[model samples]
Target: MSTRTDEVERYEHLWQEPAYPHRWVLWDTAGDVLVFDRETNCLVDFDDESVLPDVLGRMRAAGVPESGDYPGRPCA
Candidate 1:
């Protein structure tokens, strides 16, 4: 998402899952770009296959900034 060369920081947008606003849970967005669950605070390799291209494709079309890396399952 934001890792794309076409994307920029500062103006870089932060993305989140709104349905769980009170949960403080971050979106595990690696599944949308890389197949594996990326660990918390880790940098993601955008070309990884763990991502779901279909979802990214749709969101990219809507101009939504891709989410930042997040914690995987069992986040404490």
Candidate 2:
């Protein structure tokens, strides 16, 4: 499979299961953004701000609670 396809598959697998007892947040590092999976401490690269709405939409559709405004904090 192509690299892009592989990447997409990886991304899906990353979020395939919810991280219970641990919340997630979009960590903005100024240079880029990422989905910080608190339970696993997994940091998935998120390069665009435009995709936030769509991502959050999908999360809500999947029954995940909606998030508030961007924290705008640097990735620790």
Candidate 3:
């Protein structure tokens, strides 16, 4: 019973700066996918899982590698 706004607020704190040259993915408290945008310094939430590949592609084009984990935690 979570709304998108609720999801964003829940995960807001975990959103951190990406490494100098790499973008990242992390999970919210509820275990949803969140992608970091270096330029904007924020996370973008996607409703459609199908858009993941496209988002990753855009990130890669901008020089971000495939990120599958966050520190000691696995990416959701």
For every candidate, C-alpha RMSD to the true structure in Å: 11.7, 5.9, 9.9
lDDT of each: 0.36, 0.50, 0.48
Q: Model 1: residues >4 Å from true position, as ranges?
A: 1-51, 71-74
lDDT of 3 by residue, 1-76 (tens): 9764564444333233354644454423345445665445566666655655555444455554444444233334
Listed in order, each prediction's TM-score against the native is 0.25, 0.39, 0.34
Cα lDDT tens digits, model 2, 1-76, are 4554443444453344665542565555665445666555666455554555556444445554324445334458
Return the TM-score for candidate 1, rounded to 2 decimals.
Answer: 0.25
Task: Report clashes for each candidate as comma-separated counts.
Answer: 6, 0, 0
By lDDT, is 1 or 2 better? 2
Best-matching candidate per TM-score: 2
Per-residue C-alpha lDDT of model 1 across residues 1-76, encoded as one tens digit per residue: 4553334222122223333221222244545343232334333334434333543454355444334544445446
**Evaluated with lDDT, which candidate comes out highest?**
2
Candidate 3: stretches off by over 4 Å:
1-44, 65-76
| Better-scoring candidate (lDDT), 2 or 3 | 2
C-alpha RMSD in Å of predicted model 3 compared with the true structure: 9.9
